[model samples]
Target: MKNLPLGMNTLAKLIKQNCVYVDKTQMAWQLICQPGAFFLSRPRRFGKSLFVDTLKEIFEGNKPLFKGLYIHDKWDWTQSYPVIKIDFSDGTLQTRESLDRRIYEILFDNATRLNVTLSKGRDIPGTFGELIRFSAEKYGTRAVVLVDEYDKPILDNIENRDTAKIMREGVKNLYSVLKGQDAYLQFIFMTGVTKFSKVSLFSGVNQLTDITIDAQFGTLCGYTHHDLQTHFSKHLDGIEQEEIKQWYNGYYWLGETTVYNPYDILLFINKRAQFRNYWFETGNPSFLIKLFQKNRYFLPDLESPVVTEEILDSFDIEKINPLTLLFQSGYLTVAHTFTRRRRMMFLLKVPNLEVRIALNDHFINGYTDLVNEKIGIQDNLYTCLENGDIDGMLKVIQRLFKSIPWRNFTNNDLADFEGYYASVIYAFFCSLDAEVIPEDIDNHGQVDMTVKLGDQIYVMEIKVVDGTNADKLNCNPALKQIQDKGYADKYRGIDGVTVHEVGLVFSKASRNLIVF
Candidate 1:
């Protein structure tokens, strides 16, 4: 078996080093078959850079690297095109000045590599246009431009709206030159994590086809199950294939099949087949956590988020939708699709176990501020469910709610809403890797939350009372509703399953459980 290509992105280098390579040349050939600009959006570390490098090699006429590849015979190796590559996957760029400097530096490095002297005293756009025209002219063929991580500058400053917008405009200025250089460019491909709206970032280059979700190219960047079983079967011998699939395989793009993140699979095999959040831990999602709290987003909504096509693409620095952010960042994947009122809609879900656990853990931290206490809380909660101790479970939950800093409630009236409280509990249970079902359906009605652990099941109903009614504990509204709706009836007759119905009522004034 060939060695794993961990942290290796260059196709020539990977091939030379005898690394296991999932042949993507057929998809690459499809992309460059026509002379047009294209764009691909994938999460970071999804092998976009390596794919870009593969395209670079093909365009550079490196035929020796094409041995035994899918496009080996189909592509005309005699024809080589001038390739201009730009990668923005490096360190963060904070200010507009820094962004401009980085663009200049990238342009200079490209010019130096191609031995094309740039026009003196020209700005970023001018220099970029000059480079494309000169390179194409010198090589006697139009240039093929490839950009990797095209939106990193903007994403780096995503937490700061003003700076993010500034970075957006700066990159837009550099990309705007592409439309004018059409005559000098044979093909163009840009890859990034987020797909900024055409009007915002790619207004000048509206001709670029966004194949992010196009079915024809869905498996263009990630590894298919076939790729795994055919290539890495030896390395993963004796491992439970079903377990691996549950942990790291479920990313989809409306294709015939789903894909696994190459980074996750590679690391999982390299680390002795241990299942860890290898991909999720590489980058911090502090901004995303803050967005969730600031928006008071119901955590359960992510269980199966149904959004219109417009919502999926409605992303901008000024108006950042958390769902869009999550979807584009690989935290969510489309599970189903349908049409209503002539509008396309998508039903999305967390892709796999790794994302579900890690993402909820982050949200739990944001909601409860129980960084150090979370492990103890999860342990106690797990033990309570294992022992069927309802009172113990209630105390553990109450402790979590009390741990939230007062500032989390001061900015908004979130405490008055049942969703706020339900969301917190949902995050906690989900982070425990339990079978947590929010808005779980039954014959009679929908339950607020249901958690199944081993042979025990917990059905919970949450309610929030007004401040004036806090002192009056005369009503058991939450528990009464659960009983009246027969929310636990669905699982009561299961052979080995034990059902426990619990009601939690919170006060608007105190924001803690008043009745449990």
Candidate 2:
């Protein structure tokens, strides 16, 4: 078998080096066959760079590299076009000055590659406009412009609105030049993780078509199930098909099929098919965690977040909805959609077990403690539940709640609600990568939560004591409620499974936990 294409984004090199290729050239063919500017937004590390490089190779008329590819026979290999490519992933752009420098460097590199003279100007917008017209004039054909990570500068300074705004304006000026150079351009393709509204950056380039949610190109960058089974059968010798799908497959973009992150799959296959947090570990989740920490967005809402097109498209330097950032960043994906009041709305969710596990781990840290995630919380909870030490588990949960600074409860409007407590606990259980069902149902009515381990089931009922219930703080009403409601009945018939009943309570007056 050929070596896996882990971290290999150069299409020509990947193909020539005998790396496993999944034949996205067919999709590539479709993209270029159309006439118009196109934009694609995919999560970081989802092969956007590879796709951009593939386009570069194809337009450069590198026929030898395309011998067996779908576009080899279909494309006019004899017609070589001038390609001006700009990649924004190369440097730090924390300020307008830095952004100016980065844009100039990228433009200079492109101009040199195309052998075109650029008009000497201090302004990037003018230099870029001149480069396009000059390149087309010299090549006797329109130029193709490919921009990879076009939003990096803005994303890099997202937490700092003032810095990000300055950078956005600078970058906006550079892209605005593209619309004026339309006469000199053959095709324009821009890719990024965030799909900021056209008004923010691309209002001048009005012809740019956002294919981010287009069904036809949904599988363009990620690996599909068919791709895995057909091209990676050798690697699937011992790995369970269902397990693989559950771990990484389920990123949807408004189509029937779901695609898996290529980064996760390549690493999984290379590491002897061992399941792990491959993609999540490649980047830090701290920025995302901080977003939730500040907003106090309920963790459970991540499972079924509902938003309109406006919400998904609203990403500016000064304002950002947590859902938009999470969806655009690959931490969440389209679960499904509905037409409500004649308007399309999408329900977003964590894509798979990998995202759920990784996100909830941070959820525990950012939501509960904020001070320490290194407390070995995951391991301690795992140990407690595995040994059926309910008391230990309760104590650990109490500690998790106590780890929060006093200010969190007093300062945050949303943190004191019982829903907040339930959401954090749900996040804790889900972070274990276990089967945790929130708001589970039983014959009697509803259970607060249910979890299944190796051969054990846990049924829990939780409550909060308002000051009116201060006299009942020491009472085990939670246990009485669970027994009275028969919340454990759902697991009664399991032949070998043992059911553990847990009743948990938090007292507002005492600011503590009680367990029975």
Candidate 3:
């Protein structure tokens, strides 16, 4: 078996080292068949950089690297175009000056490689336009431009809105030059994590085609099921295939095929097939979590969010939508789609078990004060649910809520809002790997929360009341509401599974569970 291409992004190195390569040259060929600007957006570590490098090797006419590849026979080896490359995956640039320096270094390196001298005393845009024109003039053919991680500079400083905006304009100024060099450029393809409106980042080059959601290229970067069964079959011997798919294979791009992140697959095999949060552990999303909490977003909404096409397509630094950020950052993915009022709508969900567990784990931390104790609580909760121990589960939940820091409610009205408690509970259930549904609908009305665990199911309702009346209940109002509304009736007859109706009440004065 060929060696796995762990952390390898360059196409030439992978081929030369005899690493397992899923053939993407067919997609590359299709992309270059026409000469125009193209843009693709994908979450980080999803093989965007590798695809960009593949395009570089192809455009440079390195036919020796294409041995046994699909594009080798189809592409013309006699003609090679000048290629200018820009990659921002190396280091973080915090300010405009640093970003400018990095841009110059990238342009200069490309000019040196292409043997084109940039005009001295020229600004970035002027120098870029000059390099494109000169490189095409010298090579006697139009040039191909490939940019990897095109939005990284702006994203690096996203915490500081002013700096982020400045970095945005700086990169925008550089990309603006591409518009005037249309006659000199043969093809332009840029890859990034997020998609900004053309007016925000690519107004000058507004003609660029965005293929991020194009069905034809959906499987271009990630590993498909066929790839796992074929290219890396040797490495997957004795491993539970369904388990692997459950952990890592659910990302879709409006295509028939769902794919596994190459990073996760490579790391999974390298670590001897131990199922872990391989991809999620690579980056910290503290900013995203903070943003979600700042917005007071209901954690259960992430179970399945319905969004319009406009919500997913437009991203700007000035107003960052938490949903868009989550989707673009790979924490959420498209699960289903439908037409509502003649408009295309998407049903977004956590792609797989890896994301569902790991993301909610983070949300648990963000929503509560018990950081170190979360794992213990989640473990106990899991056992309680699996064994159908409602009393044990209630004790664990009360313990979980009792640990919340008072500061979480001091400056905020969280104590008065039932959603605050419900969201926290929802996040805990999600972290336990329970099949949780928020606002679950029934024939009568909507259930506040529904959880399916092993052979047990729970239909729950939450209510907030003042501490003065906390002791006056003959029946837990939450449970009474569930029984009154017939929320559990829908799941009562399922074979081999027991349906449970649970009601929980919180006291505003104590800011904790009062009745369970």
TM-score of each: 0.97, 0.89, 0.98
Error of 2 at 86 (Å): 0.8
lDDT of 2 by residue, 1-516 (tens): 887988898987898899898878888888898657999989989999999999999999999988877888999988988999999887677878778887888898888988877777557878998889889999999999999999999888877878888888888898899888888999999999998877888897848888888778889989999999888998787679999999999999866699999999999988888999999988777778787767766666665778998887667666678888888889889888899999999988789999998888777766766535534766898888877778888888887776767766665555446677877888888888667777777667887788777777888877877653545556677778888888887789889888898887776654557545
Candidates 1 and 3: which is better by lDDT?
A: 1
What are the runs in model 3 whose C-alpha is more than 4 Å off? none
> Model 2: residues >4 Å from true position, as ranges?
370-380, 383-392, 403-415, 439-448, 452-461, 466-503
In Å, residue 413's CA in model 2 sits off its true spot by 6.1
Best by lDDT: 1
By lDDT rank, best first, the candidates go 1, 3, 2
- Cα lDDT of model 1 by residue, 1-516, tens digit: 899999999998899999999999998999888898999989989999999999999999999999999999999889999889998988989999999999999998998989899987999999999999999988999998999999999999998899899999999999999999999999999999999988899898848898988889989988999988999989989999999999999999987999999999999999999999999999789999999888889999888988987777658888889999999999998898889889888999999999999998898888778889999999999899888999999998888888888987776888888998999898888888888889989888898999988899999999888763645777678898899999998888899888999989998888899887
Report the lDDT tens digits of candidate 3 across residue range 142-204. 999999999999988888889999999999989999988899999999999999887799898
For each candidate, the alpha-carbon lDDT, in order, equals 0.90, 0.83, 0.90
Better of 2 and 3 by TM-score: 3
Alpha carbon deviation, residue 354, candidate 2 (Å): 1.7
